[model samples]
Target chain A: MQRIQWFKWLSLVLYGIPMLLVLVFPFIVMVSTSFKTLEEVSQIPPTFIPRNPTLENYREVWNIIPLADHFRNSFLLGVGETFLIMVLGVPAAYALARFRFAGRQPYLIFLLVTQMFPAIVVVLGVFRVVVALGLLNNLAVVATTAASFSLAFCIWLLVGYFSAIPPEIEEAAMMDGDSRLGAMIKMTLPLSWPGLVAVGVFAFMDGWNEFLFSLTFISNDEMMPLTVGLFRFISRFQIQWHHLMTGSLLATIVAVALFMTVQDKLTRGMLAISEK
Target chain B: MSVVVCKELVKRFGATVAVDHVNVEIQDGEFMVFVGPSGCGKTTTLRMIGGLETVTSGDIFIDGVRVNNLAPRHRDIAMVFQNYALYPHYKVFDNIAYPLRLRKRPKAEIEERVNTVARMLGVQHLLDRWPRQLSGGERQRVALGRAIVRNPKLYLMDEPLSNLDAKLRVQMRREIIHLQRNLGTTTIYVTHDQVEAMTMGDRIMVMRAGKVQQIGAPEVLYNHPANLFVAQFIGSPAMNAFKGRLETDDGKIVVATEFGRFPVGDPLVARLKPDRSPTLGAREVICGIRPEDITLDDAPVTPASPQAQVDLVEGLGADAYVSLTIGGTTLIARTPADCPPAENQLVTIHLNPNKLHLFDPITEETLLALP
Candidate 1:
């Protein structure tokens, strides 16, 4: 028994070390490079940690690139798009989960078909539509389009979540003097909070990092989101390594922070779907 | 309090009929139960009356006023579901106060009613806790409290005690019966367990294949079942049935089954036809006998006795279930627990005439009693 226990511990450490390194190594490299000067970043074996770490690269990136404006734009667009997706997706999901109506199957199939198409294929058409609507330089257009793109996926996630809740709960509410709509609000919606959070976080991440739509729709540098603004650090001939690393690190930090906040909900939603 | 009447109620889902023209009158302050096997439409019928399910075609009357088109809330009925259906996030107090809150009752009145019902159900201590924090029995009491606070015209319970452990189910069953009696609310409960129906209902509606087979007081249904289904369903160790030919010997009728012959007393024998099919349907009848009705004796002192070897003995403390094989047929005899015969022990068994049930093999209809 002791030998087996020793072997189990040895194997756990052996497996865990590489997994930890793989996950943390990239973030460590990015953070270290963010603090290094342009000269230090171009060193012959890339330094694990900066020899003389400084906040100079962060100040340069912030001053040279409108990094603050990009941050604000990204935050606003991501939150707006995620909120819209949830507003439209939650009720649609509850309807699909609870009620049997005409054209329900066809509607679900159409929604699924939207996810099957690659976003690049429709980029030109989407650009044309935005231009025709006179929304080419507007952040609202990018936010709305991104939200529209994520709506189907969010609804799909929420449908599974809503269905996982026992129908008897809603029926019980109905017996307690609630209308069908009231029952959905009182019982079904609250029970599926984890799914809502998971979908919200996913839409937020997608909108935060989306590049093609933001780049095509918005020409004003001030309106550019983080993903598009980050490209300003790179030119055709050379890359500003310090500025690029700082900006990337900041974006990574924001994404990771948002994800960590809702990580429990995401795991729970995924588990609920898999169980069904 | 008001009586509920369902007349010629029919509910069809596509091509299948769930409740086929069921008609029942539930009296005011009476506890009525709809009992049957799964998919027998007992639940469907209850839901129709509760207005949870739309009636395909029927008239449902509460207090002699037709309520076929009324919403469940408008009909003033409260239901307790099989899973308890307590809102997991709500405290027990909030759950019990839900109906009153929906009615926009005064806050103080809601609080008083919620507390009163919670105290009655012995769940007053659980009011501040969420449903997930309570045990199964506690959750059930909160669900009951939620229903009782409404003081609706009628109460509908759909196997509310089914999810509990056996001991808790029995305890809750008694509590529900006592509570309903004290409140004097007309109730319509649905359950697949005949034991619950027999013990708790003032009258049980036994259904099969979307049709009601019998409806009567528990003892009446047990002693005089309307058909083969009721005869088999109501008893604990379900009534044993033997297929046999009915024959007249010396101007007396005898049912000659594979197990042996049993005399059909004069009144019952007259109900059998002499000329019957080779299927043994006319002469062929089913002899229904409860296990308790078969007497096991050491000696065959009577002419109406059949000899058999005991196959198995199940001692249930209060009674012994002895399985015996006679002429290639198995028969269960309920005897005194202390004097149970051993397996393979030879014994003479006699079928009590008064306890025998005769049914037409073809129609599966009870022949002894005419309705």
Candidate 2:
């Protein structure tokens, strides 16, 4: 048994290190490049670690562009999309989870079918709608678009979470003198808190990292999120690889931190429907 | 207190009928139990009266008010589910006090009522604990406290004690009976255990295949079952049945079976339908008798006693069940544990002639109105 244990761990280290390095290599590159000077970043035989470590890239990256304004735009878009997805998704998911009606199976299939196609496939149609509404370059338009794209995913996840809870809890509440709506708010919502937080975190991350729709919809520099704002560093001339890496690293840390906090609940919520 | 009347209640799930036109009127403060095997519509009937399931076509009246259209909350009833359904997020105090809080009762009243119920159910010490922290029996007590706290018009319990261990089930059974007696509230209970139904109900309703087979006081059911199903279903060591034909042996009526012939007493013959008495000759019938009615004696109790070979003996402290067979026909006879016959020993089995239950071969209905 001891020999078998030693062999198993040896195999894990042999296989796991390369797989892990593949995942974390980009973050390491971003960190190392963000601490390098402009000349050091452009070196042909680039040093994996900085030869002369400095915070010059971080200081220059902020001064060169409206990085603070970009931060605010991304923050607003994430919070906006999360709020909209939860507000619309909670009730829709609850209805799908609890109510029995004709075409329910078909409707669930339709929700899945909505998620099968990529957003790029319908980007033209969405762009047409945005132009017709005369909301070009609007942050609200970008947030709304991102929210619509992820609504199906949010609803599907929340339906699983809500369905995981025993319906008898709500039925017991109803028997105890609460209306159907009242029972839902009191019994079902409290039990589904973990699921709600998981879905909200996912929606926030989706909006925070979103690029395609924001690029297509928003043109103004002040309204641009980090995804498009980071592009200003790249010109028809030389690209500022040091400043670009610094901004990308900053944006990634926010999303990673949020994900780490709710990692436990998120896995459970996702596993709920699959387990069923 | 309220009187609940279900008028021709029926529930259908698509092509299958779950409850087939059940009609029962529960008296005020009566304890009515619906007992049956799985898929027998007992739970469905209870759910319909609780307003959880919609009635396909029927009327449910509570205290003279037709509540078919009313919501469950409006109907003013409390139900204890099989799993107890306690709010895991709430503490024991809040779980019991939820109904009053929903009704917007004053803080002092809610606290007082919750405390009173907790004391009554012996859960006052666990008031601060969550449901997950409590044991199965404690959780069951909390569920009971929640049901009784509101003083609702009626209580509907769906196998509330089924999840507990056997010892806890019996203790809770007695406690529920005592609590119901003191409260004097009408309650409808559903369970598949015949022992629970027999012991707990003021009137037990036995159902099968979405239909009620019999409904009466427990004694009435045990003494005079409406049909073959109840006769066999009610007793623990189920009533033994033997296929036989009624015939005249030397000018005396007797049931002749493959094992042997036994004379049918005059009292039993008088209880049979008078109109069919003339045609009773050579009529095939099922002879049913409870285990307790069949006595195993060392010597023949009567001149015509049939001797049986004891196949197995199961002792239960006070009494023992002896499985006796004669000519391939097996019958269980109850005998004193101290003097049980040894295995494979020959014993004279004397079936109490007066206690015999006769059923028709085709319809399976009782041929004699047992006195």
Candidate 3:
């Protein structure tokens, strides 16, 4: 057993070293570049780490871009869109989950069909509609549009979650002095919380990093989310590599934080879905 | 306690009639069980009575009041599902208290009642534990506790013990019967297991093909089944049925089969239709004999006794089931397990004519009753 354990650990280190290097190498290079002066960055051979690291890149990025406002806009839009997706998607998913009315199968098919078409195909029409509605440069409009684009996926994910709960549990509740609606609220919803969290986190990440819809719908700098705002760091005349790298690192950190907050729930949701 | 009456209750799901027109009356505090094979509409009937399913046609009355339009909660009934249906997320205390909470009972009363029932069920120690943390038997008790805490007008149980292991099933069966008796609560239990029906129910309702075949006490149904379905359904190993003909032999009625002619007693003669065909209406009648009623002897005592060849013997400790072939007909005789005759041994088996059941070939109705 001891020999086998040592061999297994040896193989694990051999396999893990390259994977770790590949993932961390880029972030390390970016951080090192962000800390270097323009002269040092332009050197023939790149340095893995700067001789002297400074916080100047972060300060320059914040000063050059409306980083605080952009961060606020991204946070607001992502949270709002994800919340709207859950609010609208859960009920629609539940309706498809429990009831058997006419056109239910077609309705589900229609929702799935929405996911089939890439966003680029409908971007023009959606832009025209947003312009007509006079919501072209509004963050609320951007959030709503992002929600509409992602709601289909959220509903699809939630449908699997809702349907995974045994119908008998609801029936048991109904028999235990509850109406159908009451039974759903009291039994099914509580049991499916993990699935809800999983889908919620997925929608959050999707909206947080979304580039196309935010770009097409919002043109104003104040309403520009982090994805679009990050583009301002690059120009034809000169590219501020340090600020861009710092901003990219910041975005990665934010997304990772959001994911880590709900990581346990995500694992539970996957287990729940697979078990069912 | 309340009397539940279903008058011509019918349920149709799209094109299939899950429950056909069926009528039954369950008296106050009576433990009525609907027992049948799968897809026999027993669970559907129980659901209809509980108002879980909408009635296609017919009225359901509780305490002499029509309740077909009432919701499940308004019907003031509680049900225990086969899978226990204890809320996996809720602690045992909350699960038993859910019904009372829904009814908006006083908090003190809910707590008191929950604790009382928990103690009664011997689950007080498990009150803080979630349902998934409990064993199958403990979960079953919690389910029962949830149903009983409310003191509802009726208790509807749908095969609650069907999920347990064999030994636990038997143990829980006795507990359920004792609980029902002590509480004197009207209950309607549904199960496909006839043993549960025979042991637990005050009256067993045998159903088949979305209809009630027979409704009687266990012993009554066992001895005097209303039809061939009930006879075959109610007994373990089932009643042995063989095709035979009813004939008048010297002013006495006798069942004539391919094997031989056996005299039917005078009590059964009046029930036989004289105008029926040689098959007792069509071409053959069914004769049912319980395994216990047939006896195996080492030698034939009289000329009329039939000689049997023992095919197999199943030693069951207290008794042995001996399969025998008489002429071309095969039958099983429950005999003493000790000193059972060896396989292929020739023996004289006597069929107890008094305990025989005769059914019409065409209608499958009981043509004669045992004395």
Whole-model lDDT values for every prediction: 0.87, 0.89, 0.85
lDDT of 3 by residue, B1-371 (tens): 99999999999988898888888999999999999999999999998888878899998999999999888878889899998887776789999998888889999999999999999999999999878788999999999999999888999999999889999999999999999999999999999999999999999999898988989899999998888889988877778888987776766667777777777655555555456534343346799889998877887788776788999999989999988898788898888888799999989876677777888767898865434
Candidate 3 docking class = medium
The sequence of per-residue lDDT tens digits that candidate 1 reaches over residues B1-371 is 89999999999997899999999999999999999999999999999888888999989999999998887778889999998888876788999999999999999999999988887889888888878789999988998999999789999999998999999999999999999989999999999999999999999999999998999999999998889899999998989888987776676667788767777666655544344322243367788999999998888777556789999999999999999898887888899899898888888988887678888888988876542
Ranking by DockQ: 2, 3, 1
- The most accurate candidate by DockQ is 2
Q: How well is each residue in B203-237 modelled by candidate 2, as lDDT tens digits?
A: 99999998889889999889788788989999889
Evaluation by DockQ, superior candidate among 1 and 3: 3
Fnat for each model: 0.66, 0.78, 0.70
Q: How accurately is candidate 2 docked according to DockQ?
A: 0.53
Q: Candidate 2 regions off by >4 Å?
A: A1-12, A51-56, A235-238, A254-276, B249-252, B274-280, B300-304
* Global CA lDDT computed for model 1: 0.87
Query: Mind giving the per-residue lDDT tens digits that candidate 3 earns over A154-235?
Result: 8888889889888878887777778888998888887897777778777777778878888888778888889999887778
DockQ by candidate, in order:
0.41, 0.53, 0.51
In lDDT terms, how accurate is model 2? Answer: 0.89
lDDT of 3: 0.85
Model 2 Cα shift for residue A99 (angstroms): 3.5
